[model samples]
Target chain A: MADINAIAKQFTDFYYQTFDTNRAGLQNLYRESSMLTWEGAPIQSAAAITEKLTSLPFEKVQHKVTTLDAQPSNPAVASILVIVTGLLVVDDSPSPLQFSQAFQLIPEGSSYYVLNDIFRLNYG
Target chain B: MADINAIAKQFTDFYYQTFDTNRAGLQNLYRESSMLTWEGAPIQSAAAITEKLTSLPFEKVQHKVTTLDAQPSNPAVASILVIVTGLLVVDDSPSPLQFSQAFQLIPEGSSYYVLNDIFRLNYG
Candidate 1:
């Protein structure tokens, strides 16, 4: 079995990369059953999540991860729980907002797709 | 079936209350298989988590939750994935540190115990 930490690292890299470069393309990372919570607002399903993310007020955003943690949730389904703390600069703004995000990734064939995702801005 | 959001709210209330009043008593919220990652450091088992939490530098701490989100992870095991963003004041400090925590709670009889817990401070 692949190490959960390694897989989480890879997923975070791919996730933020796609999120920064192309927000709409993030839909591929989710399934029909996927759920996304953005700043306490719930958005369900892949297409809706993609739409919500793409419709963000800022046009450009970059995330710099400060910490990433993961643990195996269920060996039966090979699901991994990953949490990330990061700084995000939106629209080339000098002020970066601190944020945290959690993702539950479950196996889909040889790879994984996000099942549960929750995000929050940590500071005002 | 109970709502995951309600359960998550209850858990957060109990957790922060126990944490602020009696840090040692928070041990009951975990299981032998529990994993805790505190600010990127990994601690396994309930005992270790309680110890780590209790041994923090501050004598008094309080958590004010800003947002809480939860989603049903596995119906078979009745596991819920919960994420919280909050501000923590340590030792009555004027500055409140922003933080985020994630929990994977699985049913144990009528209640739930944390199986995976991860926490991180949002900023330096």
Candidate 2:
């Protein structure tokens, strides 16, 4: 029996850490078929998604995760579905903004890669 | 190739309609292995999810979808990952609350069933 909870925990920890520190490194976590939707704008493919993510205006940011939920969405494919809600502060901003994200992770060899990712800032 | 966009559009419309009108009826769209995380609380299985949903405080509510994004997460399994952001007015309240939900739908026979669902109201 695969421990999905443990995998999800590890993945999220690495994900946010990489996102906050070395965003360009995050590209390895996706594949050519991967898709990302950030703030209602869709970006396809790993390279494009990485480019868009690394192009965010702020030079530095920090993510504080509030909640993490995971489910084995497709056991046959060893796919884990994860949802996250958190607060993020960009640069020296006085306040943090709330955001939510969902990820579909599929196994690739020993590790996993994001097949689908969607992110949204809580407010308009 | 499956028309994921069309499928997602139909599913979201049906889901919001059922949620607003007959929450209990949403059970047909789920299976025994389904999992739901509602506002950070985890609920396992379909029956429990429907129960918790029907037990929500508000009697009447309306959902206005703002954005809908879907990706073919697992092509082999025909799994579609959907993310939705919307506003909901509860019990004739003048103010509408923002919400976000993610669903992983897998085909079972002719239709689909929700394997994983996570929902949160965008507020404190």
Candidate 3:
């Protein structure tokens, strides 16, 4: 009874906006109880997520989604693959970082959020 | 164009047969260049795969597939979620091991081979 495609689009749009200035619009995309786990930071809460985002001086950020696979008729869930490229504004020099992330989406009612995201700093 | 469904079944059948006292019928399923990587042994060749199976004594092995979601009409590839439940025939006692594996299927004509299988020994 849910629109998974619409939910997936909204979830991706939030990530796209996060690059504008640190994680400017990231918080709005997740539920208050959202959980984030990664290498350096195994698990984090929504507040921690926001804190980590603005910790870096990012001049500009861009992301490219490689794959978006959704199960048929499963409006509440989807799997997404993203390649994030960002520039760190530090020491008056810009250094870029590339990341690949696999996201698990969960939709509640008309709104959708990310449940789990496994990411790695890709070098290859 | 190959049938992805058939290929996946064959791959699973080979794994099921490998638990019969030894790898009785595993060689026929894999290509000569199959690469196997796990925690204990990072990478292993076909010979190594065969050796690992027979190294342990087993009266029987059984597997249950939980999810089998495949790309439509893409017979050459599919992503499978398998729960392999097996008994280890050590000390003449049957100890069950449950494994969750994500398999990457590669089909060469009528025969299908596994390109990658990432598995973890699940506890819980």
Candidate 4:
């Protein structure tokens, strides 16, 4: 049986820690066997994902999680709503974006890894 | 027992009809006693809702329901994902907004009405 609260926390923490200048902490959160799909892009391996993240131009990216709704179904599956308040420090410009984040999570051992994520921004 | 497909259709049609200048068709889709919540606004009557819609600057509005996933549990509750591709003609400007639309549906007799909706837009 998977502890849903712990899984959800690890899932949320993955995004929050991505803000760090050192990408190793964020990369460590995902299992080497994990899959992460963003938008409609091709499924990437955890190592590939880490490489992509570290290549990004932004100096720092902070995600303040606003909501965490977890729905877990034993060993099969789990889903969570992770609404984040985004602040990106890029080129000395601070851009703030608010969005409701949804992550489809799957568990491996006691920890869970993200399968797919949808970040829907709210703007006029 | 309510047909899940039928309920989903009616809910989607309501938003599409609102795009038409004739407000009555859209109004007809909702039960007088039905509750519709958008954003985090207070509950308002169907009549009040109609007034609010008609008062908007948009001369026309259309909702393209891209996806609908329904979960029904007997007479107690149901939920549907209604993703709308929105196009609003406001002040002679055509504004396009793309987002995933979610409706929390509750059944009343043979028909299901929306309890609340969350629309999350995607922007860079």
User: What are the per-residue Cα lDDT tens digits for candidate 3 across A1-124?
Assistant: 0354454556665676565644746766555545554432444456766666666455555555433322221212333222122222334444444343434454457555654444444332
lDDT against the true structure, per candidate, is 0.90, 0.86, 0.44, 0.48
- Give me the runs in candidate 2 sitting further than 4 Å from their true place: none
State how far residue A49 of model 3 sits from its true place (Å): 1.0
List DockQ for all candidates: 0.79, 0.65, 0.04, 0.07
The prediction achieving the highest DockQ against the true structure is 1
Please provide TM-scores computed only on chain A for all of the candidate models, following their numbering: 0.96, 0.95, 0.63, 0.63
Q: Model 2: per-residue lDDT, tens digit, B12-110?
A: 999999999998999998888898988878888889998989899989999988888788777677878898888899998988998888998988889
Q: B1-124 in candidate 4: lDDT tens per residue? A: 1365466667667665654657654554444443433332333456766665566555655555544433331122344333233333334456665444544455557665554344444344
Q: Which candidate gets the maximum TM-score versus the true structure?
A: 1
Off by over 4 Å in 3: A1-7, A71-96, B1-124
lDDT of 4 by residue, A89-108 (tens): 34555566544544545545
Tens-digit lDDT track of model 1 for B92-115 = 999998888999988989998999
Taking chain A of model 4 alone, its TM-score versus the true chain A equals 0.63
Q: Rank the candidates by lDDT, best first.
A: 1, 2, 4, 3
Writing each residue's lDDT as its tens digit, candidate 3 over B53-123 gives 55644445455443332222121233322222222233445555434343444446755565444444433
Stretches of candidate 1 exceeding 4 Å from the true structure? none
Model 3 lDDT on a 0 to 1 scale: 0.44
For residues A32-114, write the lDDT of model 2, one tens digit per residue.
Answer: 98989888677888899999999999999998888777877776777888888788999969888988889989888899999
Error of 3 at B94 (Å): 43
- In model 4 chain B, the worst 10-residue window by lDDT is B68-77
